[model samples]
Target chain A: MKLLEERIRQEGLILSAAVLKVDSFLNHQVDTQLALEIGREFGRLFADQRITKVLTIEASGIQFAMAAGIALNVPFVYAKKKKAVTLTEQVYSASVHSFTRQETYQVSISQQYLGPDDKVLIVDDFLATGAALIGLVDIVNESGAELAGVGCVIEKSFQEGRGLLEQKGVRVHSLARIASMSPGEIHFVDDPSPAYLVKEML
Target chain B: MKLLEERIRQEGLILSAAVLKVDSFLNHQVDTQLALEIGREFGRLFADQRITKVLTIEASGIQFAMAAGIALNVPFVYAKKKKAVTLTEQVYSASVHSFTRQETYQVSISQQYLGPDDKVLIVDDFLATGAALIGLVDIVNESGAELAGVGCVIEKSFQEGRGLLEQKGVRVHSLARIASMSPGEIHFVDDPSPAYLVKEML
Candidate 1:
C-alpha cells in the first residue's frame, strides 16, 4: 500500500479537486510488476476468505481482478458492460451509473459462472461514487454467493463509496486512499496532515 | 500450448461454425493459472524479440496482455475503445470493425506510453477476423514503435484473420488454432484430421 501511495505521489496527476490521473501506470497504461504486487497485497489482505472467484466490471477493473485472481489462485469473472452477442444465456445483472461518463450502463455476468457454490471477492481500480462497485455487489448477492469483500486499487476516501459499502457490511480495502487533492497539492488518509482528515479523526 | 488445446477441446463450446465460446476460461470467467501459462507460452515464442512492452485492446485482451507482461517482466498497455473523460491528451488511434457485434469502434492509446524506442508484443484472446488486432498493429506503427509480433490465445484458422495478418507481413502466433469446428466437433490445426488440413498440407 505504501508503494502504491508512493507511485501515486510520484506519477499520479491531480487534475482537479476530484480527478486523479494515474494513466501513466495504473488504468490506461499499466505497470505489470506493480499490478502483480497490488494483487499480492490483496491476496495477503484477504488470505483467510477462502475466495472461490474474483469479480469486476469490464475495461478498467479487469487487470486488478485478474491480478487478484492470480494471487488468490482462482478464476476471475468480469461483468460485461453490455450483453455481447455470444452471451446468449441466463445472466445476473445490475445497472450502474457512471458520473464521469455521465450515462448509465447495465453490467451482467453469465449465470453459469457464479452461484451458491462460489465465494466472491470483487476488485476494481477506483472507488469513488461507489455506483459501479455497488452494482457488482448487487450482482454477487443476486448470484447467491458469499461475498467476502471488495478490494480497490485506488480509493477516493472523501467520496461515499466506502461509507456505502460499509453500510452494506461489505469489507473494503483500497491501496491508495486519497484524503483530498487539487491542482498542485494532494493529501492522503495516510498523510500526516494539518488537514481536515486529522481534525475529522479527532 | 497442448494444455490450451486440451482446454479448448474439453470446454470450448461450438455455438456455430464461426462462433466458438471459451468464455468459461479465456474471456468472461478467466482461469488465472491457465492464463499465466498462456502468457508464458507467448513469452517463450516471442522470447527472442526482447519485447519492451506488451499491448492489447481493453476488456478481453487485458488478462493475456498482463499475463504476457508478467512472464516477460515488462509493462503492458491497453487501447481504450472510447476516449474517456479523463483521457484528454493526444493519442494514436485506429478504427476497427467487429463482425460479431456488428459495429465499428475506435481504439486509442495515449501518445506518451509508446514510441520508437519500444518493442511491442500485442496479445489478445481471439484471432478471428483480425480487425481489432490490425487496429492495434496500426496504432503501434503510428506511435513509431517497433512491433515484435502478435500473440493470440486462440485462432479460428478457418477465418480470414491469419491470412490478413500474414498479408500485412505481421508475424502471428496462436496457442490453439482451430482448423474447423461445428456443434459437436472441433478440430485444431494440430489435429490429425481426415479433414482438409492434411490434404491441404499434402
Candidate 2:
C-alpha cells in the first residue's frame, strides 16, 4: 500500500481537487509489475475469506479484477455496462451513476456465474463517488451470492464511497487510500502501514 | 494452446455460422489459470521480438493485455473508445466499425504512452473482422512505435482479419483458429498446435 501511495505521489497527476489522472501507469497505461503486487496485497488481505470468484465492472476494473482473481486462484466475472433500457437475458442488473462521466449506465452479470453457492470479491481501480461499487454490491446481493467484500487499488477517501459501502456492511480494502489532495500536495490516510514502518527504522 | 482449444471445444456456444461465445471462460467470466496460460503462450511466441510494450483496446482486451504484459514483464496500454466526433488534445485516434454492435466508435490512446522507441505487440481476445485491431495498429504506427505483431486468443480463420493483417505485413498468431462452426458442430483450422501435440501423445 505504501508503495502504491509513493507511486501516486510520484506519478499520479492531480487535475483538480476531485479529479486525479493515473493514466501514465495505472489505468490507460498499466504497470504490470505494480498491478501484480497490488493483487498480492488484496490476496493477503482477503486470504482467509474462502473467496470463490472475483467480480468487477469493466473497463477500468477488469485488470485489477483479473489480478485479484489470479492471486486468489479463482475465476473473475466482469459485469458489462449497457445503455439499453430493458434487460434481455436472465441477468442480475443494477444502475450506476458516474460522477465523472456524468451519465448513468446499467451494469449486469449473467445469472449463470453467481449463485448461493458462490462467494464473491469485488475489485476495482478507483473508489471515488462509490456509485459504481454500490451498484455492484446491489447486483451481488440480488444474485443470492455471498459477498466477500470490496477491494480497491486507489481510493479518494474524502469522497463518500467508503462511507456508503460501510453502511452496506461491505468490508473495504484499498491499497492507497488518499486522505486529501490538492493541486500539488496529496496526503494518505494517517494509519497506513508505511507510516508505522517508517517509525520502526533506526 | 491445446488447453485453450479443448476448452473451446467443450464450452464454446456456437450461436450461428459467424458467432461463437466463450464468455464463460474467456471474456465475461475469465478463467485465471487459462488466461495466464494464454499470456505465457503469447509470451513464448513473441518472446524473440524484444517487445517493449503490449497494446490492446479496452474492456475485453484489458485482461489478455494484462496477462501478456505479465508474461513479457512489460507494461501494457489499452486504448479508450470514444463517441466524440472531433479530436481533443494530443491523441492517436482511429475510427472502427463494429459489425456486431452495428456502430462505429473512435479508439484513442494518449500520445505519452507510445513512441518511436517502443516495440509493441498488439493483443486482443478475438480476431474476427479485424476492425478494432486495425485501428490499434494504425494508432501504434501513428505514434511512431514499432509493431512487433498481433496476438489473438481466438481467430475465425474463415474471416478476412488474418489476411488483412498479413497484407499489411503484420505478423499474426492466434492460439485457437476456428475453421468453421454452426449450431451443432465446430471445427478448428487444420494447422493447429493441438493436433500436432496429440500426434506426439501416441
lDDT of each: 0.89, 0.86
lDDT of 1 by residue, B37-139 (tens): 9999999999999999999998899999999999999999999998977787888999999989889999999998999999999999999999999999999
The prediction achieving the highest TM-score against the true structure is 1
- lDDT tens readout by residue for model 1, A132-201: 9999999989989999999999999999999999999999999889888866566888875622211110
Q: What's the residue-level lDDT of B184 in candidate 1?
A: 69
Give the C-alpha interface root-mean-square deviation per candidate.
Answer: 0.7, 3.8
The residue-by-residue lDDT of candidate 2 on A155-181, one tens digit each, is: 999999999999999999999888877
Query: Could you give me the TM-score of model 1 versus the true structure?
Result: 0.95
Q: Evaluate model 2: give its lDDT.
A: 0.86
User: What tens digits encode model 2's per-residue C-alpha lDDT throughout B1-202?
Assistant: 7789888877777766787777889988999999999999999999999999999998889999999999999999999995222123488899999888888998898888899999999999999899999999999989999999999999999999999999999999999998876665667886433321111100
Clashes of each: 0, 0
